[model samples]
Target: MSTNYPKPAVRRLKVYAFDPQASVTLATAMANDYVIELPWEQRWEAPLEKGPVNDYVEVIDIDPAAGLFYAPVDLDDAWLRDGGLEPSEGRPQFHQQMVFAVVMRTIRAFERALGRVVLWARDERLSSAELPPGAIERNFTRRLRIYPHALREANAYYSPDKRALLFGYFKPPESAADVQASWVFTCLSQDVIAHETTHAILHGMRQRSIDPSHVDARAFHEGFADIVALLQHFSMAPVVRQLLAASHGSLREPGLLTGLGEQFGRAIGRSKSLRYALEALGDRARTHQGSAESIAAAIAKLRETTEPHARGGFLVAAVFDAFVTIYERRSEDLLRLARPGLVPGNGLSPDLVERLTQEAAKAADQVLRMCVRALDYLPPIGMTFGEYLRAIITADTDLVRDDPLHYRVAFVEAFKRWGITVPGCISMAPDSLLWDSPRPEEYPALIARANGTPEGETPPQARMDPDDALAWWFADMLKRLQFDVAFDQADDGLGERSAESEEQASSCKVTYTRRDYRSGPAGGRNLRDLAMRVVTHNQRAIHQWLEQCTTDRHDWERLLGVKLTPACARVADVNAPAALRSISGGTDPDAVPNVEVHSARISRRTGPDGSEMHMLIAQIVQRRRAYFDPEEQKAADSGDKGAIGALRWKSPDFWFRGGATLHIDLRDGRLLRVLRKRIDDDARLARERAFRSGDMIAATAAVTGNPREPFAFIHRGS
Candidate 1:
């Protein structure tokens, strides 16, 4: 492609607002069709061969049960590119288009929130010593594969092992006589597509979160995905306006906007959608308008629910409740302006409806951003709903110093109503819930070094603190990462460009003329391109730096909450060729533990007052072999070479991971806070053992030996 050729900023595609079934209704027949706009790919070559592939996802329409390979939708085709293949139940290409568009939209939302390009989970096998150098980076998955028609059953899920999404289609049950469509495709549903995509994205961010470690572990995955999917419906203003018109500008009412998987739910013989966030309000509450008693009963029911979807529903409800509160607060003035004495039965004027729709959409967008931003602040493993609330508070507080809109307050009150409470917090106040800041006095070494005299000559009050040095060293490493440059360029290109403006730019018919889209200072370099370049080119350097930080640093074991010395006895000599010899049992007692530098990226967020806060978010992970047997676990914990060597050479029952997520302020070289899970915490270890031995194991047990495909089982019946 020539540089002079004009490339469109966005590609508009028509899709169903809710699902194909919504179009069948006489009132929603025309309103159900929605046109979504995606970023245009100027580099895509050969429209027919490319299919609906993009930088983040690839749509592969393969149906094994039907023994059919549906031709991939050529999104680059001129006619299709202009307006997209019309929403149709009969066409398989339309299904491909729908999945691709929704997946990209979800991905873009995440990238915008996180301020970086999304990277899929790396292949675990490539980390072995047997693999050649640079194999991990060379084999990094850049695009998530999307199979619109893979299974014959009703379930659809994201497979971490295959790095693909498998969407299924099924015939409407005989009991579902009201369903108009004979076959229900999960790919056609925007909620289903977005939900599965979130799983993939979340797994990439925290690969170990899929483990069924506790009640909240797996449930968090299901609930968070549901929340994302449900909130996404409000992003489309036109759709929200139409939905508001039906419900009289009330989100409390039962409607397509609040329901998920409507067509599939109906096809599966359900009177309603698969799930509703408003259900947390209780039937009586929704029917009889709102009441404290009905809300209290609903919250109690949420506490009793244990199944993943049901439990996760409470999380969705809590978040949706916050959104509702925020929306109501924002639109209260508008409601009053419409009618001073606005009664329950009074009709909303067109102007009031438009204003309320905008308020609802804005509130939803803010809530969604807060939720997504909280992901970076969460501990890399073992996430709970209570901790998630803290993450949300801390993340939002960091970006927006002042909460004039009371968004954080709304989140806190809602989570509390749903029985979610953070441990160790003095109160439900937002300030109390914020992650504790690192005190310099507690870290004597860093303070001494900062105030030390010379390298050789120490001051009277000088004292060496290895842990503080490590923190500073990590900060220096972040400085070397050069995230600021990449993010600065990304801001110039992507941050300022709004979806509305992009759609308008590409709306009019135009010819491919001499024009340059790369006229900006970024020069066509995006955040992904720049960030990936830094990571891929410096993979070995990063590994070496991490190894150096962990080597012989006993203080790091306490500072990072991970074991650094006394490498696992089960690790083969080939894997640790440079292992330090131990006096007892000839084991490698001094060998350095494997430290995984999971991710280091920049977060550039603009506050409500036009203030910018740039941060370097990094995660460091270390895993230790854990045993189910109490005696064997004691032996492993003893740290005695002879005792550790006496244990069986067989693989342990599971790996216990400990790591910290570091939030470094770019304005100042300060380690703001560290969110960590301790690997050697006896209490946590006991909890893990009990969880594995108890019925919780059944919650996420895989049909096959492969545990990586948990979503297959999680979404089995959904």
Candidate 2:
């Protein structure tokens, strides 16, 4: 290796490696120039003795010894992956070491093909004799590509065999830093750069996409990178001295205040490093996400709702939490490995960073690979709260097989309580080199998808038959209430359609007896349990409040605060007021639906038709609908509207549907009353009004025509 006018070229091929320089630094604290200092005990054995690079990847020419490297520039079309990699006390040193591990793994993959050392360096400023023609690079302080929309670069291409990762950022050079961020190395602070580049290299080794649609995806992206980047700071001497002094000249259990950024913070007379944080918080670490409590709340939710950061932003928060644990744990692990009772601020040799970085690199390498593999099966679009739970389950399902010791079991099962299930596609079998599962891809059950889409699969929809739709909604609510009482959990997995069949599952059953109604005027009933669940309930609540609204001759006021004419809440009593009678049809029965006659659970028989029906009954609800069509809306907004069709809820009109004939099922038929009620007494006489879906009601069996004869219970299906 000669340091001449021109640097020797280093072939860029991905490979596997064991950096001896790192090992020496870890085993001893000797001032070996080659052996860099490591803060954590990072020592990992390489998995493959060797591997080869295939297509979708090629060796780029670059000189490592002379500090110059050449690679292709095709990042503009690269897709960003939300690979979920994080550091933990049980694993790598922290964020910085994790980054190094990923980078080293990537470089080794390249080395296997190109057979040379790899160096991450920005483009040289001066024209060198060995420099290629038109090799201009914009630094992170200068540029970060342009138009960073996920749509433009939504698909990343990687070839493990090729040992190449093809991607780019939307970092267009707008101002100085925007331009500077363009260079892969310059886009991040030194630590952040090392961390981000590690992501690139890791992508080439095992292709994956970090979920971008969810908070966890974004957080993991930043957190894991931060951990990796920070650990690398220890590898440099100048930075190490600054870190040690700030740490009060110690290392064991020392907080990050010892790092260079902390010293800078101290120089400015602040408890924390604001400048460094401002610079690092954007794309790498989001630890300063407004308030620590908010971040903790998110983390707690992640833990409670999903396993090992499986759902919500838990996956994202897990990475940072893992970093904290890993940093403290590695510091402790180091004490056990060498010093017995080392205290914080007791500075170790600077070379220790290289050791920690290498060890961290090795630990990071394996975990990241696991993350990459998990991404292939995740949903391509919108991530709901449920999806997050599944993400963690699917991710660690494999990790459980090889490294269960390091990966906690209780840590994972925590998600199951939140309704997360293992993805069937991801089985115990070693997946293809590409790591794909036979995904039973399912989309959410939306009203629009009732007809099914290109996938040729959708939930069965019974269309919007006003009578049927109203009935169905009522039935659904009853079923939900029944299910909630039975299961006692919100997401009991009852509403979720099966991935394969796309059919709704029932944890509880509710059969409708009857329905009847008449158009009086829009009125509302209190739906207390409703707002807790269902989207339509929210709309209904809004409309209910508007019914009580009242107003003056010039300007009317609604009962619940909205203003309108007397027609808003028209009492169906014809004798009350002129407007009331005009709208309510001749003094509609001043009726409070009271069960005058109780029905007995008598013998019920099946008809020729498979559909089961029940005794006569009535149901009610305040139904309102808001429909939108472009043409109609435009005309209405422009004051061109004369008479617009409005969907309004008509109460006082009872809804009745489905009736059944009674038969004695009891063989020795005397009087078998599975359920009973009194009917003879005028005070006891009852007229049963079928309960609407939201109505909390009770029922009993009875004989229809004869008031004296109570319906008998019969033996049915065993």
Candidate 2, 229-321: lDDT as tens digits: 444444444334444434433333323421222222222234433123122223223344434455455445554541211232233233323
TM-score per prediction, in order, is 0.84, 0.29
Model 1, which residues run further than 4 Å from truth?
A: 1-9, 42-49, 128-136, 282-303, 340-346, 450-475, 479-530, 536-543, 549-555, 566-592, 639-648, 696-700, 703-705
Report the lDDT tens digits of candidate 1 across residue range 1-718: 5669666678888888888888888876766888888776545221223558755777888789989998877777778867789888899998888888888889989988887778887666553354442122334676789999999998999998899999998998899987888888888899999999999999888867788777788899999999999999998888888778767777876678888988888887797898988874544344662346655675577667778888898899889988888998999888777676566776777777899889998899889999999999888778789899999999999888888889999998888777676778899899999988765455444444444443335655554454455456566455445442211111334356566545533442211211213534434322233344355433323445544433334444555554554433232222321111111221125433455666666678887788888887766666666778877666655544455564452356676666778787877656788788876577887887777776443533644445767788778776
Best by TM-score: 1
For model 1, what is the alpha-carbon lDDT of residue 93? 91
**Cα lDDT for residue 299, candidate 1:** 58
lDDT of 2 at 353: 44
The local lDDT score (0 to 100) that residue 47 gets in candidate 1 is 25
Local accuracy by lDDT, each model: 0.72, 0.27
